[model samples]
Target: MRPVVFDGQFGWLHPAAGPHGVVLCYPFGYDALCTYRGMRRLAERLAARGIAVLRFDYPGTGDSAGDASEPGRWRAWIDSITKAVALLRQSTGVERVSLCGLRLGGTLAALAAQQLGDVDGLVLLSPVLSGKNYQRELRAGYRQWLSMPAAMDCTPEPDTDEFVEAYGFRLYREALENLRAVDLRRDAAAPARRVLMLDSLDAARVDALAAHYREQGIEVERRGFDEYSKFMMESLDSEIPRAAFESVENWLAAGSGELATAARDADTHLSADDPQGHAVEAGVTETPVWIDGGRMFGIYCMPHASLVTTGGTPAVLMVNTGAVSRIGNARLGVRFARRLARQGIASLRVDLGGLGDSQPSLDTVTLDALYAQDGANDAACAARWLAARGHPGVVLLGICAGAYVGLYAGSREPAVTGAVLVNLQKFTWRNICDETGKPTVRVAAIGSTRSYLRSMCEPRKWLRVVKGQTGGWPVARELAARCASRLRATLADRIERITGLELGASEERRPFAALDARGVPTRLLYGVLDDGVEELEKYFGVRGARLRRLRRVKVSFREHMDHAILSASAQENVMSYFEDFYRSQFGEQPGAVADEPADSRDAGRSGRRARAAQWLARQARAFRLSGEA
Candidate 1:
């Protein structure tokens, strides 16, 4: 095992024989730390075939320096990998390089390959094709968290960046926005070479994409890996798909002697505790920020360079669930912050109270209590945090229930300049079972007329009698008994009363109405296929025409793309839209922007383009509905 540093860009490098060549490997987030079975196996196989392999971590991800909340560093990540490739060539005397990536890494590799005039091959494993799809999945997960009953007691301080739950790390709005702007296929056009694509039998989209690549005359070959666990989710252990690895080895072994000989002689490597060599910079000052009366806490990411200023930069504050920290969210947040920073924009990903590293004070309140109060205090607390930082012009960006909080905050705070609500929801009901083994709606019922008459119209007395008498096998059975006793009762009336009260209370708060009056640009992003769309729309009166100037986007790509914006293709497309929107509104300036070339790789690629086009078309329809087009 050889540890190599290419001009301060650290990575794990495996050498191969014959003509020196390079293969850059990129891992999905979290997957970078937990498992590298597939990556390590591929590196060994390629190294044996004379292809040197190099894999490194993105800053604030594995072992790299800086915080994930710094959105201005995404380009830095791409630059680091590109520089690593160049350094690998200098270190090994390799004249040719092949880029290999898994998931988001595939998208990043594709982007890097497009800019570098390297004469080589490219391999993408289930690359993210759409950003909107990934965001949708993220939104869904957040909505699920919000729907849980108050008994779960899962609530983070509003405006904080971190959360702690059963799972490892959870990312918030900053991360989601950053991931939303990453796309690989947009400008990824490399010279046709031996392109190998691996797909799972169950992955119909990947299979279709592979077929499309083959038709493009790109020398593409598709190999199916059966029964391999998904590498994205943390649920899978670090187990290599041996069958898939061997297939790749066989394919490379059939290539030219230079490639084949290297494959046979390369060193066999083990999955290391940390393969990316990510290290934090020392002596970095960490400033603490308060949210929800110190119930939630966050660390501010200050600029490292003198040229980077906090002045006049549009600030974005993020919100997340109780499963991850601001740092995890920074994985995505840092990307956007970096991009925006390059454009003279600033952002902050806060740790909500009671989650991650943030410990609530005695006076700090819980999310359940805040929800009961319609999130007013929580929103004000976030606004005050920004105001103290001299960031008066702020944008409220949230995911899932975070969206709810953002809406609530934006509605109340006049300092808010804009609002980005992703996957918003109104109300969530918990399933309650009756003694008869059937699902029953849970609501407060009013006393019956007969009971009232018997009690001489004493409502309190009747209520006590019902509470004492209603015990038993099933709620329905008890209700029937009450009805038999000449008590007036109906599910519809009770439901109506509950719904009216909830809505009436919400309206009385006047948060959304205030936001509209404030003219704060509000952008609501959601998945067209999101199950919660109808539910969310029902509560927050559909702002049909209002969303146009506000810039709403509905991602319609893959049906299953989650909210994290994990899909490679979706990531690329969504980033394109994001960049376009940001540039259009913020004014594009030289040096403040990076030019991304048009990805013509799929120009001649027959089937993939057709399928992608169809998928994009469907997404386009959804975007049009939101007036994004």
Candidate 2:
């Protein structure tokens, strides 16, 4: 599968020539993000089974070219499905096309099939039968997430009458209204010649939808989506329902012709040279690039023809946030990149080697490769890409694990002129690889664990802790020990700062010291009670006061902060801060790097990295099917 863009929507095209092609419609909002990797695996399977497939992000979502707040997004979403169907047919030259969708995507698929009037088949897996009911579920889910004791400190206030949220994604008022109006039972023609329905929670709605299809004399096959609960979840642990997928594949394959070997052979080594970007907005364009020799992937968003184009302004580099891909949690990365473009800055958001669209699974990647101190080689590739693209330098921004990667990569990469760290949990990670070469990943405490511990004062919380609610009691003990060392560490930090020298061993100050030598401006933002702040207080005084000793270091603690930028207000807060920060540092008239010719040396380095990456991309790598926890 290769990345593609059509009608300003980004998608992966699993190319093959067969009697049938598939357009896999993704559910809206966070569900789409959760199922991203699984959907990719499905597409790969379908393609291997001799069926071409195009799985896409709807407009205003994912890697597509728009913002979530735009009015009439629901209409645009339906239209996007229609567009995807056409693109798949045109690209694959298959007379028959099937629409397979999960959750809200399933709803969209049925609707789009009806619109097309000639779709061969429709598969709805745990689909939303009624828009109004789906909206109610969203509200319920939002309430449950907020009510969790662990989320109390970071809970967001949603307007009871106005807001509809799904984890980090929220629907706008008009869009919510549009969603409520979708009632599939109301005299809609059967969407396709044949239909497969995978029912999960709401049997009544599924039965109603099935009856509606039967009324129109459409052949319908209804089955239980037995694995739905585990399959539809946060990506890291979301199971890929292999049995459910097999049923759909068999159904689609029953009447489909074999894929033409000639066409399949022709697709080898897809010409991945930076595809031209469609206009994102009036002055900005986003081109999807397979950089690092095609071994890595990123969406390069650039600001065009800016009066703010001052020399020496660096582009921005956004890495994966935690285990999430290039889009970032709640699509903050895409939102922020476009926001920067409006401010006359360019940015590239990359999925590091083992995350996002990048091939290797997190299960296979060593802890040392992604989370540890010296594990930012992939980001180094992106920085080099930016430098060769004519950017004098780049500013690295990351949240969570990303922050750790950015801080280390920025300090080391010569082209990095600035670094932005948000809710950085730990300054270092412990890596222990086994003799078999597969790293035994010893992950540090994530925010959820810390949140659980913070509430351990309660008896119920202590019971849960004792029962090993935190994976194991050993982790809890380790956290307690770290907490206890704070006083000694803080005292040591004070002595070292006053003397302008290391007290004994190097601490968090090492990276900043290196960055300081290169005149890199570093900014650290944190929530008041965040786990990362404890380290800051221990090493640089409470709220990073002694951080001032490193002339280039600046820190901010915001009241409306969450470990993940989950809420609308939190996202607004971070974007506003970055805007002001950029203007203050780069001046209002500053410009990002441009597409000027790269020096031979810089080009050579970029070329080598790109070549290596591309070569790696050529090797056949298998994707997860059943999934692992």
Which has the greatest lDDT?
2
The Cα error of candidate 1 at residue 509, in Å, is 56
Q: How many residue pairs clash in all the candidates, one count each?
A: 64, 5
TM-score for each of the candidates? 0.40, 0.83
How would you encode candidate 1's per-residue C-alpha lDDT over 1-629 as one tens digit per residue?
34454443435667665464556556545545333435655675677666667776665563345544466555766677678787678766776677777766766776777777564676766566665675454445555544432111123224333321112234445555556675433355442366777756236656655555566556777766563454443312234556766766666555534453453312333222223322134312223444454455443444444434444444666654323334433254444544454544445666555333344311122334324334434555666667666764776666555676677777777667766665454343343544542336533242222222334455775566578864334534544654442211223223444674322224423554566577665555554434334343333322221122222222122222234333333234334544553444344441221222123223335577675774465345543333232
Worst 10 residues of 2 by lDDT: 620-629
- Which window of ten consecutive residues has the lowest lDDT sum in model 1? 543-552
Off by over 4 Å in 2: 148-151, 259-274, 360-369, 372-375, 432-483, 497-508, 538-541, 544-548, 588-629
List lDDT for all candidates, in order. Answer: 0.49, 0.74
* True-vs-predicted CA distance for residue 326, candidate 2, Å: 1.4
Q: Could you give the C-alpha RMSD of every candidate to the true structure, in order shown? A: 20.7, 11.7
How do the residues 402-481 of candidate 2 rate in per-residue lDDT, one tens digit apiece?
A: 89998889888998988778878777566666664345663434443335555665787567756877455666676676
